[model samples]
Target: MNAPARLRMSRTALLPVLILVFCVVPLALASAWTLVLLLIPVAVAAWVLRVGVDIGDDGITARSLAGSRTVSWTELAGIRIDERNALWLVTTAGTEVRLPVVRTRDLPRLAALSGGRVDVPAPPAQ
Candidate 1:
């Protein structure tokens, strides 16, 4: 079996920092309201970071506490890099799925692995 290519969860870097700055720092500064108000962003960040991705010879897989999905390299048509710098895998069905944080920088790498190109498409008109 081909060895699995491990990718660390993206939230591992950002969540702690946000928690420290917004939650811990505010509490340290003795601001109750700040801590309370920051909770929303903190929760959202936590939720966002919880998603992770892994790649290997079989293809690419995204795992989260919520669920897991494996996408074959062939099934992945291409990648779209958003203005926000988010990388999404384009499926043959024309649906776009956001890659996990760990796979953010992995776009170019994935493109290289799939022998494809990385192109950021223009956003649709508002």
Candidate 2:
């Protein structure tokens, strides 16, 4: 069996996090108050870096700023894409779990990871 596919924020999404951390370093060194402000960039980086989705044969695991949750294939009722292009996993209990950083382009990978549990929508006729 193939290993799980891990999806994370694209490098473009991470650029702002890196820039903020670098920009804050100077200010953080200058003042005590600024030092406290340093936490902002650190938190942003952590949030951006930690948020991801892991799809394996067993289930889908989503990690966010709050925490991580894994839903088995049997637990998922369906998957849908929102107007914003975010992927949402609808649970058997009717709960929606939003997958951060999951774009439309990632649907194929997600479908494959789920072993056909999730359906990948067909592309619109061009």
Candidate 3:
């Protein structure tokens, strides 16, 4: 069977989950203030996870928690893994679109599709 389209996790999803676990957990047990803080991270996580990137035969589709975008293959520039380890889709114009999520196990698949390069551009000199 032909494999399914690729979907990457949202890097935007991580910060909040980690924050909630580390910063909010203890505060949750002690005070209402902390409980209120919980809403922020939870909301962020929900929004980020809800968003996703779909790579299919037609092209790549990026659906954010708030909206969705579709770009044809012709517009695809490349892909890259950031220093933070998030996968980003680079457009021909050089804009970096963050993928929904990234997993180590998925690297091989992504690399294959990206032609062995993740499109990670070199950092500009200071």
Q: Compare candidates 1 and 2 on TM-score and give the better one.
A: 2
Give candidate 1 regions above 4 Å deviation: 10-50, 102-105, 111-126
lDDT (tens digit, per residue) of candidate 1 on 39-85: 56666666666566667777777766577787776788877678887
lDDT of 2 at 22: 86
Prediction 1 global C-alpha lDDT: 0.64
Worst 10 residues of 2 by lDDT: 9-18
- In Å, residue 27's CA in model 2 sits off its true spot by 2.8
**Number of the top-ranking candidate, with lDDT as the measure:** 2
Q: In every candidate, how many clashes are there?
A: 0, 0, 7
**Error in Å for residue 103 of model 1:** 6.2
Task: State the lDDT at 46 in candidate 1.
Answer: 60
How displaced is residue 125 in candidate 3, in Å?
24
lDDT minimum window of 10 residues, candidate 1: 113-122
The residue pairs that clash in candidate 1, if any, are none
lDDT (Cα, tens digit) per residue for candidate 2, span 65-85: 889988888899988788998
